[model samples]
Target: MNTLLTSLPKSTPLPRYATRLLGAALSATAYAVCLPWDLRNRAETAGAINETSPVTALGVTFLSLSLLSLAAYFGIRDRLSWTLLVVAAPPATLLYASLSSHPTQDANAWPVAWAFFTLVLGAGVLVAGSVARQFGPRAR
Candidate 1:
C-alpha cells in the first residue's frame, strides 16, 4: 500500500501566468472581432459611409464586452493584478492599431475617446470578475 501511494502521479494545475495570457488573448480576439462594427459606426458618424443599424452595433459592443468580462473572470481567478493585464489588452491593442490610421488631429481624438470609453468598460469587467469570484460556479 505504501509503494502504491508513492507511485501515484501528482496533478499539476495550469500556471496562473498561462491562464492570464490565455485570458488576454481571448479578450483581444473579442475586441478584434467587434472592431469592424465600431469602425463602421465611426465612419457613418463621419459621413464617410451610409448609416448602419444602431441595434446591431450595440449588440456587438455588448457581446464583446461580455467576452472581456468572462475572460477577466476566468483568467484573473484569485489574482487581482491579473485583472489589469487582461482588462487592458483589448483597448491597448485597439489604440495601437488605430494610431497609424489617424489622419488628422481631430480624427486622432476619436481613438483617445474610444480608449477612454473602453477603459470605463474595463472597470466594469473588473467588477464583474470580482463578483464572479465571489459568487460564481467556482466560488469557494
Candidate 2:
C-alpha cells in the first residue's frame, strides 16, 4: 500500500489548491462580466442593453466557467485543461469582440485583447499550478 501510494503521480490533486484555483477563476469571471458593463457605460451613459448584451453575458459566463474548469483541471494538473484553455480562448475572444458595441476599430478590439490577456494569465496559473502539483512531495 505504501509503495503504491509512493508510485502515484507527484502531481495528484490538492483540494486546498483546487479551492484557490476555483476562487481565482470565478474572480476572473466576475472581471469578465464587468468588462461589458464598463463598455456599456462608456458607449453611451446610463446602463443600457443592446444586441451585444446577451453575447457579452454569454461570453463572460463561458470565459468564467472555462477559467473555473481550467482551475479544476489544474487541481488535477491534467494536460487537457491546459490544451483546451489555450485553444478555446481565441474563439471566445472573437465571440466577445463580435458581441461588443465599441465604436472605433481600436475600441472594438479591446475586449478580445483583454480576453486574450486573461487567457494567457490563466494558462500561466494552470502551468505553474500543475507543475507544483507534479513536483509535490509524497506522504509517508
Best prediction by lDDT = 1
Worst lDDT 10-window in candidate 1: 3-12
Flag clash pairs in model 2.
11-133, 11-134, 74-77
Please, what are the lDDT tens digits per residue for candidate 1 over residues 1-140? 33211211121244545555676777676666555433433455675543453345765676556665664465335454456567665656665665445445443466667667667766766666676566543454
lDDT of 2 by residue, 27-85 (tens): 44544553434344342335543223434666656655555544444344334354344
Candidate 1 ranges with C-alpha deviation above 4 Å? 1-14, 37-59, 68-72, 105-108, 136-139
C-alpha lDDT of all candidate models, in order = 0.55, 0.47
Give candidate 2's whole-model lDDT.
Answer: 0.47
Tell me each candidate's TM-score. 0.60, 0.35
RMSD of each: 7.6, 9.4
On TM-score, the leading prediction is 1
lDDT of 2 at 127: 58
